[model samples]
Target chain A: MTGGARRADPKPMDVDALIDDPGTKIVVCCGAGGVGKTTTAAALALRAAERGRRTVVITVDPARRLAQSMGLEELDNTPRPVPLPRPVTAGGGSRDGQAARVSGDGQDGQDGQGSLHAMMLDMKRTFDEVVREHADPERARQILANPFYQTLSTSFSGTQEYMAMEKLGQLRQSGEWDLIVVDTPPSRSALDFLDAPKRLGRFLDGRLIRFLGPAGSGTFRLLGAGMNMVGSVVGKIVGTRFLNDLRSFVAAFDTVFGGFQERAERTYRLLRAPGTAFVVVAVPDSDAMREASFFVKRLAEDAMPLAGLVVNRTHPLPTGPGADLSAEWASTAADTLADTHPLAVAALRSHAERVRRRERELWLLERMTSTHPDTRVTEVAARPEDVHDLVGLREIGSALAGDER
Target chain B: MTGKGGTGKTTAATALALALATGGGRVLLMEVEGRQGVASLLGSAPLPYEERVMLSAPGGGSVSVLAADAEAALLEYLEMFYGMRRAGQALTKLGAVDFATTIAPGLRDVLLTGKATEAVRRREGGRRSPGGPHQYDAVVMDAPPTGRIGRFLNVNSEVAGLARMGPIHEHAERAMSVIRSDQARVHFVTLLEEMPAQETRDGIAEVEALGLRPGAVLVNMVGPRLLEGVELTAAAIGELDEVALIDGLRVVGATDPTGLAADLAGEVRSYALRHLLELRVRGELEDVGRPLVELPRLEGGMDRAALTGLARRLSEQGVRK
Candidate 1:
């Protein structure tokens, strides 16, 4: 896997087994944007609960209907219970097996039923909460009122990812859920999710921040004596008024709260823990697969537990009666019969297109698998409609679990 | 152009550039995300920090692409505005440059938008004279996704409360004037799906709230309607004249038409369902009250030829420079 040794066939990712194992405490689905990471997280959490685990899903930005499906109307940074779709049949075949397997876990008194909760990350509220929790009311109010703090809390690039990390740590510490499915923010690059916390941490603990801290602070007193040139230069560049505001913001923030880097480090270690698994979600496109490969390599380099890759929205291989017909033959036949039988021509044309698309998709998948042959892989067929409800999520879950195509 | 992540914003921006480059229009295609998506799509080497001619369009016009880096842009901004290249280098050594450009909440966006708007306002013959001809006929930016576009473009408001009078604030003001003017139009590219369409609508509203003009809604990757109206209805019901299809397949000299007919019918059913959903989304997009330009889903995938085809389609749809 390190040197790109190709595997004849990539191992299949067993999502069910990973979720069913109580040892897997955290499952983080991360990948490029619009690759169905959020839906995958929701579906994984739902499936984990259905299979008898106390599960909670933290989605960064879900579609309205998806949020509604999880019984979350607003992003209040609080988890709400999602009523599990009733079992298909009481004490049915698989239900009995599920209950028997999950009977030993008495964390919740629902007997055979597992519980699920979901929450969307409100980054601003989460950041504000951190301030209020760390500082006294007056200082908290002042910090919240600071224009720089408002900008950082509301529109900062890394705030969402940082807050997501904060919320995940909070959830994990609360011991409310046995399995936490975390959906990374839809950053421009998937690496943003992994890099943001560290970036924010670095910024927080950086020399510039220390230099800009209140004059009485340790670093400021130690270095400010010799850094007047730097301060004046920065002041000239950004204006004295703005610099003062930033200094005060930093001062207040420092006096009340510290060690953002420590929290980020703790979460990084938690992510590296064996109990955590990273599922890189992608689609069968060149850009997304390429991003997925980057993520896979990064996860490996970081010593994180790489569960597998979930290739969503993939076109399944062409199968059934016309399976043997090559695309060229179908296309040529369709072209020849174009004037006479429009219906048959349409059918043939579609079959040719489907065959060709599946071929290309498989080629893309092969490129990914060849790069990381040891990584487990799963493919979910592209759904015609967006997943809008619990049932849609369940269908996706089954597809993810390899229960169906 | 901004859209939901992974909705082919770069592709659409490239196609738009190619389309604008026709008829001797000099087009500058800019990608701010640092993905080099334009370079990859054009099959060119990685784009350098400086602008370079990436493609020559059909009508003797060309597209010069710049993969804008915020750090480089900040250095350029300092040198151009304050003649502080030495000071900039010093700040870089002290890590304050990185702090200001990268970690400073709104300053990075200020630099990015400043660079882009400067390009827009740049005059020919390396002069800033108002009467001089413009450098490029048009400029297209592959901006951040919809979630961040408003903040990325509304730099003045972002810094209005922070830096009230410094060069940063002045540059933000200049950039915002250019961004909010009639010359700048924030087009949205989206897929004909629920999430992307919804996001496009919300993005349009958000930009409007910031007083930026909303441009056309470029719908990317719209699938074709393969089945006829009646056939689609029947397919949706899972009863798509299968016997007739089998007969037709037999007439087309198929050795085994039964399985082929059934498989094709299944495909038609799925297609019909998807097409209906697309129609619903299109209807929703129409309610946003912006011009809609639909680009077809290329059969294989996006390549140079497919991109050219898309450019031709955009031209045919009357998308002008």
Candidate 2:
């Protein structure tokens, strides 16, 4: 049990303090799949809102339960007001409400009653909105109509990441919410939340688009004979019409969004801004922790402002006076009681199992802290039931804020 | 195999491969997501695009793994189908490979499904020839998660509108046949959680709508049930007999028996609540009408031994080898 003990314990992450800070305009929760990134982001948003900072949360791919918890029945692409169940306390629960009021930036005065708005990212619709906002109606229609754009808008791998950033940019520029919490797409693609915009930009402006653009584009002319041979081979493989549609789509997209790279770069810089904080969420398992470590390092490499790591669903040692009971003792007692006390045997066995799980979780978290010593971490104890409502979200919020049971 | 993310889809696929490989059967465990999850689960180095024996089960059976990516599959497709290796290189240089695989992922899916189905169709005698002894007894694909599996496996329909008359189109058609044929079984891996179970049900519906065969619904990471029947219900409602619990702990020669009993009672109550939820979810999953195979939760995460243990469990649960 003491195997995970370190020379000095890692710093505990101050989740309440982080959310309560007015300077923290954006909190992006990113992690691998099924690590409760959406739930964390939602809980943080709800916490931020109840703490008197108007917040909006954007979930890239929310399960129905999350949407329902936020009072959203369907994904409607735009932010809809989530009726904040009235704060239990009169003056709100935040430590420093004065700072939030001082930093209110002349937005809608909710009279210190913080508001929360929730939205699910409709990736294709968001892409269409970008086109509509940037391009003229005709070019937008043309790009929208193109079969290649249709597929790229909806089915492409990095499009979700790109659209997420694009939507984030739109939300930030709107300046309607004091805090914006973003639930990124799951898995390695969550890191794409940072890289996807640039990748999409690079892809859009890459030589392939130039080669496939049009027959007489200036860049194509520069390639000369080798280009023709390659073009013919590609033509033979993908069919001439497919290439033609791609060319037209690329040409139109280029004309519409002339400097997507620059916009992507802007969003990238925005993420690195002091106002933003990246929280990498993970469960106690090795796979999720590895991904979380990768995400932490990725954020560090990119100079992004990382707040901390949230280890969700951790099996902490059970509370009560008997918490000090050793696993070995419990198992031994269970074995001795096997004949006489079936219930005691079952209870002691379960206690041993829980103790073993806690040890394993601690070991995994210790490995992470040892590797990323500078990273702050907060552990959310495993809830017995699934979190699917506002009350559940509040419980998670309390756990996140280090409120010990 | 498909399931919600982190539903042990990869682990289930590996175990299923091991199960199918049980009797000297050669099984190809392929992952298209490029996570190299199979490699990691096998505790081996990351697998390359080529299929190689990653693990050997008992009875002389073996599991070969392939971490198939779209770019490699497309390059291979171009080379094998059109003899345009140099042209494929050109595409790579020009980033058309990236475009085809990443920017337009339908084509990527087409190539990926094409590669998997190509493995399914490949004969032992030669690369070009169609008829011979089967190369592998069974091919298990760790496919995309439930959310995207319908579109991932429905390659031909997605490509039909894009590549109307090319080798890509023809390749997608071939893959679709293998996918839609009786040979394929799209197994779904899910936990007894609301979201995963919901996704499994919906995923089955989507796959069935795409005309793919829905196989077993594997419930992974099912937790231990401490109490059952009337006691389980009583515990769930916070009505556990505390005096009996404390007496039992005292009889076991426990120190601070009262405190320990209270702690254990709390644990039991929570477990009962969770068990009830799991039972509801289990009922819903059973209503999905597929064979539901439940795998117990493997504590301390998965390793090679636990994976093989899961394979044995699958066999015991009547999963066909």
Which candidate achieves the best TM-score against the true structure? 2
Residues B1-321 of candidate 1 have per-residue lDDT tens digits of 999987989999999999999888899999998888988887788889988888888979999999998999988877887787887886787678777776676788888888899899998877647789999999999999998898889888778878888778888888888998989999999998888899999999999998899999999988656777787778878878888889888987888788778777877777788887888899999999999998987768677788889999999999888
Question: Per-residue lDDT for A230-321 in model 1, tens only?
Answer: 67778866788888888888878887867888878887788888789999999877889989999999998988889999998876634666
**What are the runs in model 1 whose C-alpha is more than 4 Å off?**
A1-7, A87-112, A216-226
Q: Which residue window of length 10 is worst by lDDT in model 1 chain A?
A: A95-104
Instruction: Give the range where candidate 2 chain A is weakest over 10 consecutive residues by summed lDDT.
Output: A95-104
Model 2 reproduces a share of the real contacts of: 0.60
lDDT of 2 by residue, A173-270 (tens): 99888899999986444566777778888888788887788678887888898889888887776778888988899889988877777888888888
Q: DockQ (Cα-based) per candidate?
A: 0.66, 0.65
- TM-scores of the models, in the order given: 0.94, 0.95
Which residue pairs does candidate 2 place in steric collision?
none
Error of 1 at A382 (Å): 1.2
